[model samples]
Each structure stands twice: as C-alpha cells, then as structure tokens.
Target: MSRTTPAPWRREPGLVGRTVEAFLSPLQDAYLRDTPSAVARLAQLRRGAGKAPEEVPELYGLTGTEGLYAQGPFADEKTEQRATVAVHTAVTLYALHQQSQRSRRMHRTGYELGAAVRMLMPSGEIDEPLRRRFVRVGTATSEAIRADRLRELVLLLRRQEVPLDYAFLADQLAQVQVPQLAPRVRQQWGRGFHAWRPPKATDSDGGGSKGTDTSRDAG
Candidate 1:
C-alpha cells in the first residue's frame, strides 16, 4: 500500500482557527495550572463555611465553595492572565466599532459621480441592511472616487483622537467599488457580510428582475 502526503488544507489549520486556538490556549493553561490550588481553596472555603466533612464533595461538586475561592487569593495568580484576555477582547471590539464608524462616515461624505454610479450599480453582492443604515445615517452620495471626502472623514475621526488608519478607509472604498474583491481579500468581511449585495430596482410591473439587479432596496 502507498501512503499519500497530507494536503496543505489538511496539514495547516486556517488562520481564524489558529487565532481562536491561540486566544483560548492561555485560558486553558491557566485553568489546568490552577486546578490543584482551586481544589485546595475550595476545601478551605467549605470548611470555613461550616459544611460537615461528609457534606464536602469532589472539586467539581464544590460549586458554592469553589466559586467563593475563585473570588479570593485563589484568583490572584490568574488575574494577570484574565486581564490580558480581557484587554485583547476589548481592543478587538473597539477596533471593529471604529472601523464601522469610519465606513459609515465615508458613505456619508458621498462619492464622486463615477464612484457613485459604480456603488449604486454594484456588479457584486451588497449588504442591503448595511446600505440602508448608511443611507439613513446621511452617508448616501451620488459621486465616486471621493478620496478627498474619505480623507476629510479620516481627519475628523483623527481629530477626535481615535487611532484609525486612512488606508483602512481607502480599502473600504475599494470594497464599495468591487465588493466581489472583498472575499478574496478579507476573510472576516467575507464571512460576516456573506449575504450582503447591492439593492435591486424593480420594474413598474412589480416583478423582480432576473439578473444581479434582482435585489431591492432594504428600505
């Protein structure tokens, strides 16, 4: 029998999968490392709580006592570890929120004529709800290639002292122009906005169009 080598996809894990594992590894290690102390602290807390010796069960069953231990010195060593995870999560969330704000700001600033037509007549999928939200937020425009507008928006956000990248804004504009290119570039954007597509206009007969224009305004 011949043995075949593993494929690249099978050999190497995905970036997102690796990132998730990396994020959880520390927590898992902390939990494993603290298990013994956690058990000891639970026993001590249970004894202090006046529970009968017979009433004490294994660590898994010592919920109330273990919970109390987790809030005390038993939690000290894990403090920095937990804080590191919390800060990472918070920063990630903030960055996402900031990107959303910048995208909305760019949409509000309007595009140049050519850019506006391309945006309105997108050849690829567009997220209707997001488009509607942009329109509602007074970001809808009729122009295209509004680099100056994007720069101004970035400047406004920078003035607020928010650390944002104008390159991100430029990339976002490029996304608006050719959304299909997004999936090839951003895995997260592709996954999150998978169902997003440009709104389709209907004929007077009330029947939907057959092509990509089949999408209608989410509003």
Candidate 2:
C-alpha cells in the first residue's frame, strides 16, 4: 500500500500558493496609486482617527494592481511560489472592496468593483467560493487559488503590506489596459484585511529574568 505524502501547507515554511487574477478589465489604471506628494495633496482624504497618512498610498496603485498574474509557466516550483504574492495581493484588493461595501460607504462605485479571491489547495480540488464563481465565469483554473487546509492566507500578509504599494503593481497595470468599468476587476487584497493578532504578552516584568538567591549554601 502507498502512504499519502504530507500536504505542503502542513509543513513549516512561508505561505505558498498561486495568484489567480481576481478581476480583469480592458481599460487599466482607473484608480490612482498614492504617492508621497499625492498623499499629502489629498489632505482632504484623512486617515482614520490616529492612523498615519502614509499607510494609504496612491489610490491608483491600489486599484490598478488587480488582475496581475505573477510571471509565466507556473510549472516550476519557484515560479509558482513567487506568483503567490499576486494571490496575496488579490486577497488585499478583495478585502478592501468587501469592507468598503460592508460599511455601506461610497468610496468608489458600489464597493469599487469588488472582485473576489480565496486560498486553496494546490490540486485545485477544493470547492471554494472563488472556484464556484470561476466555473460560472469560465475562467481557467490553472492559476486559480483555493482554500488552504491550514491557516488563513490573509493572516500571513502584514496588515500594512499593500501589494499595490510596490512598483510591480504599476508595471502590471501598464501592460494591460483595463477599460473603464469593463466589469473591471479588484479584491480584498489590501491593508487591514484581517483582524490584527491579539495584543502580545506584555514584557513588563516586575523582576529580572535572572533572580538572586538570598539563601546561604548548605554547610
């Protein structure tokens, strides 16, 4: 009898998966990716209560990074791993759209063209929401991400780690022209997508880690 091999996720390593294109459009660059100067200019759009303004970069990068497939020929292991970033990024965009929609606030047109994405096993056998939609939409599942059997994918990404903040997002957007409102794409692959890890245990110690022994040595 053949023994089953361990699942990739079960082992210890950084999060890994494919970055499926959450949304695609003919006209690209609808939203502006925030820049240092641009962010300052948008003083009108203030950050939440005590948040730093820099956290919110150019809106263009944020919205434009959608539908970016990480490099080609995902047959190789390294290639697929690197491409996972796009998957993570897609999750960011998805969260942004969801939260925006959940709040019922009109930041963009009806949740900013909310796109969808989810983590999944490598085999792509997982019956995840995104997979379900993919079938209806007829998008290829070659790079489609499905739910992981282990931890939540979004949890791995740093809260402030916006994939769009980097130049890669712009480059990807530049390549493809996402026509305005072409059922245009997007996702929760943005900052603050998941609930932050609970407050860490306080290091406030009443005494030193090395304690002194007052008791005298036995005679």
Candidate 3:
C-alpha cells in the first residue's frame, strides 16, 4: 500500500508560504519561467508588481512578507486541507481584489486571479465553509470592480493564455452559479490554453502558457 504524503502546511509556522511557493515552483517553471515571452511577462511583473500595501490581508503574504500564512496546531486532515486551500484561494482572490481597488494598472489582476482560483478548485465545486468564503471573496471582488470597471477585467482575460481547456471550469462556474461567465471566459482563453499534456504538480517542458502576475499584491 502506498503512503499518503503529508501536506506542506503540516509543518513549522515559518515554512508555510515557502511550501506553497515550492508547490507552485513547478507550475512557475512550466507556465512562466520556461519561455522567453512568458519569462518576459514574469520579469515585467516581478519588476513592477510593487511592494505590499498598508493593511492588506495576510493571504497575499506570499509575494511581499512571507511566513504570514503560518498557523499552528492543525488537528487533522480536514483542517490541514482547508488551511491549504484557503491559503491558495485567499491569496489568489485577495491579490486581485486589492489590486482592482487600487488602480487600472491592476486591471489584469482580476483576470489572472480568477484564473488561478479556478485552476485551484476541486471539481467545478468546492464544499462547505470554504465555498462560503470563496463566494464571499468573489462577491467582495465583484463589488470592488463594479460595472464600470468590468470591461477592464474582460480585456485582461482576453490577454491570458490560460492552460485550462475543458468543460471542468464551465461546469464549476455553473456549479457555483456565478452568472454564466465561464463560457465567455473559456472563449477568451481559447484553444491555445490547452496544453498537450494535462496540468499536474510538476510542469512539463511542452509549449503552452497560462500567464499571471498573481503574486506581489500581499497585505
């Protein structure tokens, strides 16, 4: 029988964000670091994503502060899983949410954040407490963006080459009843987003890109 590997969150307080970063490292390599254009995008963001804003949420700590995700005494599997998912979801969501509140410079933040969050979802649906938080975060983000600012969001989405190319996200969005935006989003991302090999923990050397400036908006 195979043993289940322990989650990275089940470790020392200081190690949490680094663990998540490590978790994302392969994705980074495949999506951003592997290609010249993608690397250029990453360098642009890394150069310009800027320092943390005052009074931002701890979720975005991955880019700015680090070690802010540390939580102690996780009792069991469920708790650990929740913490992990919440970290990724919150970081991804809040990063864009904060950006949308700031300026049009972060307009693409919403598109990238939404893509990352959807990528992190389990199925087209996430359950319970986490789902509620996700919805709350989404609502807050929607409110921040408002109708006038949504065109920017759409424009940003149009620029992405998201690696997700399937009905899963469409189904997931429908599952969340999030206003039928998935088909349109899928349309924007288009066929190039679909990599020949499916996404996994370790990214592939194959050619494809799902770009984002997801980090660097930490609170």
Per-residue CA lDDT of model 2 for 1-219, tens digit only, reads: 001111111212112211222221211122233234433322322221111213344433443323333343447665444343333333333333222121111111111111112222222234465344433322222222222210132222212121122122312222122234112222212211121121133213322211111211110
lDDT tens readout by residue for model 1, 6-80: 111121222222332343233223333555553344234333121222333342332221222333443455433
lDDT leaderboard ranking? 3, 1, 2
Per-candidate TM vs. native?
A: 0.19, 0.19, 0.21
Candidate 1 weakest lDDT stretch, 10 residues:
1-10
Please give the range of 10 consecutive residues that has the lowest summed lDDT in model 2. Answer: 105-114
**How many steric clashes does model 1 contain?**
19
Better of 1 and 3 by lDDT: 3
Residue 79 of model 3 has an lDDT of 38
How does residue 141 of candidate 1 score in lDDT?
36
Give per-residue lDDT, candidate 1, residue 1: 8
Residue-level lDDT of model 3, residues 41-144, one tens digit each, is: 33332321212222234324443223323445567665344333333332232233222221212211122223433433343454454334333434433322
Question: Candidate 2: where is the Cα deviation over 4 Å?
Answer: 1-89, 101-219
Q: Which is better, 1 or 2, measured by lDDT?
A: 1
